[model samples]
Target: MIQKSFCAIFLFVLGLGPISLTAQSLEIDADLRARFEYRHGFNNLFPDNADPAAFVNQRSRLNFNYTTEKLQLFIAVQDVSIWGDTRQILAVDGNDSFSLFEAWGQIQMNENWYMKLGRQVLTYDDERIFGGLDWAMQGRFHDAALLKYRKDGFMMDLGGAYSQETDRNDGNDFRIQGFFTYKALQYAYLKKSWEKSSASFLFLNTGFQDFDVNDVADGVSYRHTTGTYFKFPIKIINVTGSLYYQFGKANATTDLAAYQMSLEATYKKNKVLYGLGLELLSGTDQDGAAKNNSFFPLYGTNHKFNGFMDYFYVGNHANTVGLNDFYAKMVFTTGEKSTVLVKGHYFTANAALTGDADAYLGTEMDLVYTQALMKNVNLNVGYSHMFASESMSLIKGGRPHDNTNNWGWIQLIINPNIFKADLGTPSN
Candidate 1:
């Protein structure tokens, strides 16, 4: 399988080399990353008699980019897998983790306007509302159409998408099970940048397929999120903040009302950078109103916001008692090629806990060291420890909080450019 993967990369370069030489420009690149992790209690409290889990996962990708005077095309293919998931001498890959990450094209309408369509990524300011979730192995992509405008320091983007189970002509029901996705989506983003500051606004609407009690598709339930993000410098400290509100129906029968707010400040002194931040996500009480009040980050990179241990909002914690996170961070530049980062997070429930339990969830500490091994190559090592309170155990299925909870990981990332060329212009 490894040899076959290499052969595929080789063939891609060979097949596109001649055609690229006659076009305006073409570039090919590859991204490879492998990570090993040891988790005793990674995302939850450690069970008393459970053993630790350890594994290695990898992501391999190849990207091709072609550019002309008025058009740009990009395609990315990726494979994500866990080591030893497939048999050594197998003829077929049982894991079946290969996929198309992105394939999109943009056509220039004029000097400052363009249209982009196909499977692409939407990453906006601070990524609090809409983001390209790159921390996960599969990342995130959308099949959508976009109208973009950029001029001076102002930018605006309008995007929309509709999803279906297949090309069936009979019905419009999206019945693919086990995957949580939107049936229809629309969003608008606007931004303005100054010399030292920037501000952006986003309005997003998402529609989910609503089903009746008989397991039949009934209609679509819609949710709306609107927010603004700002970043500016205050003397020696840099400040960043975001405010967002969510409304509309959560499903066929539930009404939604939620909000999220965050603020952070950072300053650099000598070889160290110090930072502090707070994030508040509204939540529904244990026995509160019937409406859904829990806030969800939707498509954003939740890992980047919460603790790295993924205690909240990685895959779970949605529609639950939301989060209140207070964090502090410090980064030390040890040398020209290496750096160390240490961060601490204190967590609590935004709503009342069951049985009048304590609201304090726990505290977590994360340490990471990164070294530049070579050009386009880097090494990262990290360790995290969670000090869980009794409240945490209550929320995590009554697991004992006295068990030691920690996690460790190491990763290597390599991104290499394979080819680049510019062939003056296209011939008519």
Candidate 2:
């Protein structure tokens, strides 16, 4: 019934299209993106003599916005597909890779308060713990209702969501049995900004539902993750810091306890910028069947951190052992419209090591350049190389290290506004 209610509300807003046309209060938004990616040793620890794979991924979106003085109705739909995955000339479900990206309505209660409900995306802070993950071909979104408050640079948001197995056919298992991300999520974000400094905080909780094998019943588990980020400028150098902790009962019925901390400094002189940073995450010593000490970023844009190679803490290695990343970077402006970035990362495990395992892991270097083409088009190319030590190989599954681990990719992004209709102001 709840799902049906939400669907009805969404459809009702969509049905307002005719009214919007008559009132001249409709706005249309569209985005078309196609990127070609080539992967080779991008994940490291490749098989023996592996070949590179290249593919083109595309994402297209259509959005409708009807705005009034007191309320706003927004709906966004998208189609994502891989090149040549389906027939181009035929129209079938195989070629119908479409989904509702965002559907929401906002009620502006006053000048400083507003409430938004329905399926939407939550993006906050430096995208550390909460981000939209726009780097991926499909991107990321959430089904949540958000309450927002803003006055000047100070902002606060409190959002929450709950999920259940709504498959009516399975009448028996239709309710919440766990508290995982697929089950429930709640969070609060707060931020304040000054002239040259800013601070933000996040409190996130996820509940997982699981079925009890012995009791033949279902239950939910909850975990809590919280963090704070702060940044300030001192003379010519800028500094940023973050601290996070994770606790509560894990989905697997293990006691959760972990923490992460980071600090970074950047200096800019004319067209050149220099950066240095260090990050550490606590880990569980997996010597035996011990409790979990590893922390998870949960719903974060992990691709932006550690390194672009996505070697550490992004996938597969989650909740395994903690990680420590020490890195440096340099950015140079080629001209008025182009820039080049070069970075190096040194990685190691944070947990205690066993026999034959050392702390010295490996090093990675990344080089990227971006140049603007047209007003709405740009070109981006990047390459990275990873040099692994013997200890690194052991920690990273001990794969083949005879060949130089390398990855290269180039991307072109074109953004053009397709349509526009403004009722308030008409242009000549």
Candidate 3:
């Protein structure tokens, strides 16, 4: 089966020869990455294990690209596996399998028009709300089609996707989205030298299986988001601020109307950088009962938010107790080849109307350092410590005797440019 699949892929590439020849261009590029990670006190979050432990994981990826005058193609595959003692405890399916990460094709209709089809990563505005989540071992992807139009400082996007509905035995699901943005730095910010400032609006509509087995109704979900960001230089300091608002509804019994908002400020000077942020989620106490608030983390990448030991999202516990995060961060560069980062966060549990008015609190501290070993090699080490309040600990099923949780990891990356040949820039 593997051999057959390989042959099919090769044939598809060779079939493009006619177009490549007419364009009088041929270019190919590839990238390979490997990483190893170790974690301590990783299993304490699970109910079965409260003791500290250690484990290792290895991951690898390969990417291919082909470009012509009016068309482009890309594909990537990844494999992740456990190593040493970790394999014994976290046995995965199919003996460390490999899967397709991305497979997409783009066609340029004109200088300002393009269309893309197949699986790809969708990222916008610092990857806060719509992101690729590239930091994780297994990145996120969407199987969809996208169309984009650009002219001067104006842009527009439209996309849609469908997935197999697990709740419904019929295997039917649906998704649709539309987005628009306008950017003008010179007019909006009055700063001609600064990068562009822009505002975006997105509308999403999705359908899912009904909860009741016999119900004829199809669950429909809707979401709307608006966001903006600006960059300006004051004296020797470069500053930026970003904000977002999301309103949406789902089939869950909880209030369908939920919202999230956040504000971030950062300053950079010389080799030092500092940042501060605040995020809040509104509480919903409808039906005179405990109402759960929706927390989307739209403006903040949940994957990058390491507080709570990454237990909520990683363990699928985010639906339970709500989260409100406050954070501060700093970074310093050493010479030109190394840098260090430190961050701290405070978390509080939101109150549901009928439930406890005051829930819990937690704190997290993180430290990381990165060094360039060579032109193509780099190393990173990180440590994190989490302290949960009594309220949080109890709800999380943690024993009162347990005061804290800790985790650490080390990684190495090597990327070398194997081939580079320009096939002349194509004119669309």
Model 2 misplaced regions, further than 4 Å? 1-25, 93-96, 167-180, 214-217, 424-428
What's every prediction's RMSD, in angstroms?
A: 2.4, 4.9, 6.6
Q: Which residue pairs in candidate 2 collide?
A: 177-209, 177-219, 178-208, 178-209, 178-220, 179-207, 179-208, 179-209, 180-207, 180-208
What are the TM-scores, per candidate, against the unseen true structure? 0.95, 0.88, 0.79
Tens-digit lDDT string for candidate 3 (17-136): 545443433333333344444444342333335555554555565555667777888776666555552345443445645678889999989998889888888776556556777656
- State each model's CA lDDT, in order: 0.88, 0.77, 0.57
Clashes of each: 0, 10, 0
TM-score (C-alpha, index-matched) for candidate 1: 0.95
Task: Tell me model 3's lDDT, rounded to 2 decimals.
Answer: 0.57
lDDT (10s digit) by residue, model 1, range 184-256: 9999999999999999999999999988989889999999999999999999999999999999997889999
Q: Pairing residues by index, what is the TM-score of model 3?
A: 0.79
Give the higher-TM-score candidate: 1 or 2: 1
